[model samples]
Target: MTDAPILIRSVEVLSDDWATLKKFTFDYRRRDGTLERQVRQTYDRGHGAVILPYDPERGTVLLVRQFRLPAYVSGHPGPLVEACAGLLDEDDPETCIRREAQEELGYRLRDTESVFHVFMSPGSVTERLMFFIARYSPDDRIGQGGGDRHEGEDIEVLEVSLEGALGMIDEGQIVDGKTIMLLQHLKLKGLMRASAHP
Candidate 1:
């Protein structure tokens, strides 16, 4: 609506349960000076934050495994291995990820580096995810993190070598997008070196 390329006509709420789902009707002006009517439905589950905690000294990283209904329905038969993430209900991105790290991975992060923000699924989902990376050591654990039981989260923490994680991706084990991005980022950035472990 703010740009001249599009004009919003109407927005209708389709569902208001767990998250808000809406149908948007608009007119899009093409580069050829033609107007086209478009209708799209977007699922709004709010934005979220995700963090990958890595130990450069050990050349290892922390991850979690949990059941995802969407992935299950999409033909994955088991729990998904992913980086720590949580929705930003009423907290900022850093605050939300810190809480998620404690609840999901049991690590008290000291310094966190903001990586980037992305729209994981911009086609239909109206959720923006903030990405981060933090250094973690063995001594950062404060509790047995398996997620909040009241939230029906039964997570399993994983500590694997950086190389092993990349192999998992090739083996179709770690298929989550955010997890893949963080792992690849760590590798591409050379944040951890082969000599780091020795």
Candidate 2:
């Protein structure tokens, strides 16, 4: 709270089962002369990185389908179609995404360009995500990646037309927030050509 509008009065650990959940008690000073105390719960699971691997030559994008318990409990019928992503465990965003590319997508990505960093769920989650886009070719395929089974990751790789991926969002087939953001970001940046095909 050095230069923040709020001062942290106290912090209590609410849960540490998987991610660390804490309850923060803070005193917020208004623009006037009023000071108010507020409490907020935040979950911290560390930052992560996600990349959309697109083949400009083939006009296709590499995605992954995986089962998410939260999505299932929240009422999704089955697994979700999403970009290749992983937590930046002990590495930087670039390195983390490179490793995830191989572990989840079976692609060997060399150079990557970052699009942006975002706080997906600011109100309740204390995690930041880095979004990236990288070009790929058919020769970059290295192995059959489906993620680590011991970690409960049963991933299925998908190679779909860029146009089809955009259409899936309209049809509710792709609902992952970060994935949607990355796809739209590319569209807005004029990187993906709707007519490009391989």
The top-ranked prediction according to TM-score is 1
In the range 18-55, model 1's lDDT, one tens digit per residue, is: 99999999999888888899999999999999999999
Off by over 4 Å in 2: 1-3, 195-198
Residue-wise C-alpha lDDT for candidate 2, range 1-198, written one tens digit per residue:
345789999999989988999999998888785788999999999999999998766678899999999999999989999999999999999999999999998999997999999999999998999999999988999999999889989999999888888899999999999999988877777776555442
Clashes of each: 0, 0
State residue 133's C-alpha deviation in candidate 1, in Å: 0.4
Every model: Cα RMSD to truth: 1.8, 1.8
Residue 157 error for model 1, in Å? 0.3
In lDDT terms, how accurate is model 1?
0.94
List the candidates' TM-scores in order: 0.96, 0.94
How far out, in Å, is residue 58 in model 2?
1.5
